[model samples]
Target: EAGVTQFPSHSVIEKGQTVTLRCDPISGHDNLYWYRRVMGKEIKFLLHFVKESKQDESGMPNNRFLAERTGGTYSTLKVQPAELEDSGVYFCASSQRGLARSYNSPLHFGNGTRLTVT
Candidate 1:
């Protein structure tokens, strides 16, 4: 019954450094998603995982970013050679597998991790 949880609510790193964000979704949820909102921009989808497989990753920004779901229980997002443009609030969400794509499904979200690249 717990909601999604994200670690390191805030992070400040230098450009070219590497940072990893973690997310633990609600138990029994089968669909996980990553999203971010850059300065002055609306939140945008980054990627999605269904169980341990990546269901969609077309929204990922670039090659420097990597996403993984371990054992279909928790997820991680790593950004290497971080750029200032990558600074934003990264959000994690989850929903039941079959209900995810439907309008009636509700996605539970984490508080989000705020990353700042200097």
Candidate 2:
């Protein structure tokens, strides 16, 4: 079984530009999550998606960020008019359906997409 994969390991863009990050989680995994660490801060959750529905999005910074999981297969995070504070390492993780809410369930993470906004 392959692990999660994120495209464009590194991206550099202007402050007002748009950037989109893609994540392909492991096959058969039903729970997908987006997380990020900005400016050396600890990783923080951005959102959670179960299948094609969003279960949580409390950690999302603002309205400029959008997350989608179409067909419950792959996921995407688009940041329109990216801000300097949005620069960070965005991580994608996934686990089995019901296991996600359990403490013992292991989440497989991608290599992460590093975004730099200048």
Candidate 3:
């Protein structure tokens, strides 16, 4: 199965510009998650999508950030009016539902989308 993939391995933009990062999860996987590690902070969960529906999004930083899963397949995370503090590595992961229940079936992360807000 193909693992999660993120686009533009890296991005750089001005403080007020908008940027969209894309993620493609493994085929047939029903669960997709978004995570990020900003500077020295611990990796934090941004949101989770069970298929095309957002099961949780409590961790989203602010109104400027948005996440979406269309057709229960690929997902996209958008940051509008970026800020210097937005620089970080964004990761996407997916797993088979039943198998994912086990700790062994950990989320498969992409190399990560590195965004640099100037």
Using alpha carbons, what is the TM-score of model 3? 0.92
Q: What would the per-residue lDDT of candidate 2 be over residues 9-96, giving only the tens digit for each residue?
A: 9999999999999999999888999999987589999999999999999999999999999999999999998999999999999998
Task: Record all residue pairs in model 3 with backbone atoms less than 3 Å apart, i.e. clashing.
Answer: none
For candidate 2, what is the TM-score?
0.94
- lDDT to native, each model: 0.94, 0.95, 0.91
Where in model 2 is the C-alpha error above 4 Å?
A: 99-103
Kindly indicate the candidate among 1 and 3 with the higher lDDT.
Answer: 1
For model 3, the superposed segments whose C-alpha errors exceed 4 Å read: 99-104
The RMSD of every model to the true structure, in order and in angstroms, is 1.6, 1.6, 1.8
TM-score of 1: 0.94
Tens digits of per-residue lDDT for model 1, 6-96:
9989999999999999999999888999999988999999999999999999999999999999899999999998999999999999988
Error (Å) of candidate 3 at residue 107 is 0.8
User: Which pairs clash (backbone N, Cα, C closer than 3 Å) in model 2?
Assistant: none
Greater lDDT among 2 and 3 belongs to 2
lDDT of model 2 at position 100 = 38
